[model samples]
Target: MFNNAINAYQTIQNEGLSDRETEARVLTQAARRLIICQREWAQPNLRERLGDALQYNQRIWTIFQTEMLEETNPLPLEIKRNILKLSQMVDRRTMDTLTEPEPEKLDLLIRINENVAAGLRGSVTGPVGQF
Candidate 1:
């Protein structure tokens, strides 16, 4: 309950931000968390926390895929398909990391999230994130 409250408060802090800003923030936050989770994989007490972080990241991608797949979504079909494929890759990679609990396995997930975030933030020139 306390954790949910904290999360709600944190979410509320970003309530007035634009959608692009929100997306960039979410992506960056997920990537940052995965980085921390990766570094702490060897700690005895961090296993559950690591799993939760992976699941959190997965949930973010799932949301993106769901939104992109909607008929009202304005993105081109090719872009939507590409995003869904990337999300699926993230899901599979997350499961692989969760199954083996390896720090090294987080590299690809980190790269994907960071790259997508960068593109969304306009730091990288791309046809991404029109939504």
Candidate 2:
């Protein structure tokens, strides 16, 4: 699944979209999928897996954001700066959460999985326009 997402991200980049936009979309979708996967796999060890996945996804986003900021893309400089700031905020938050100790870490993962599942279910069953 990660590989497939990476391929899709690459396709988007190849099609002339700015790396920032392509990465934002890909990371958002990947994060959603990781949450869903954690909810589905709900095992005792799933918290560790979720933490790892979160770290990996954040790393991917950070790398993409860094590369995009360094590149001389045609995107407006201000927009690029904003994207970098947002990406840094996300990276910091994810890192802070993932670095929490044991039980706290587990609790965080469970809450995240539950929230994602709730949102996913709501989107699927609620009014068509709600999501």
Candidate 3:
């Protein structure tokens, strides 16, 4: 029992946060970057900040898409399909934002990230529309 406990502890230490937690953290970070740019819209570096934030969000969603597409991914088929659809929306919106450069346009992306993170963290007390 002691050896098993030690092995479990070692595994935890090596693995760190679970996949859900890691995903939630990354989503939160992406939301944070967008939020910063949204709030600092008047700043001189707003374009650069917004571009960076949008790219970061795109990268995150792209990673999710790739993971969901993997044969070994354990998520349900419906869930994977839904995530892929969502990533496509993110890609479209990101491109629109990049070309037009509007502050209000980031709102949907921010809410999406926050709501998804909340769901991943198992703290989604309300619907996505509420976020």
Instruction: Please report the candidate that would top TM-score against the real structure.
Output: 3
TM-score of each: 0.82, 0.53, 0.83
Q: Total clashing residue pairs per candidate? A: 0, 0, 0
Model 1, position 17, has a per-residue lDDT of: 70
Selected candidate, larger lDDT, 1 vs 3 = 3
lDDT by residue for model 2 over 58-130, one digit each (tens)? Answer: 6565665866677667668886776577567656656676665333333343343333334434432321212
On TM-score, the stronger of 2 and 3 is 3
Which portions of model 1 miss their true places by more than 4 Å? 1-14, 125-131
The local lDDT score (0 to 100) that residue 18 gets in candidate 2 is 73
CA shift at 85, candidate 2, in angstroms? 0.9
Which model scores highest in lDDT? 3
lDDT of 3 by residue, 45-80 (tens): 898879878987888788788899999999999999
| Number of colliding residue pairs in model 3 | 0
Local distance difference test, each candidate: 0.75, 0.55, 0.80
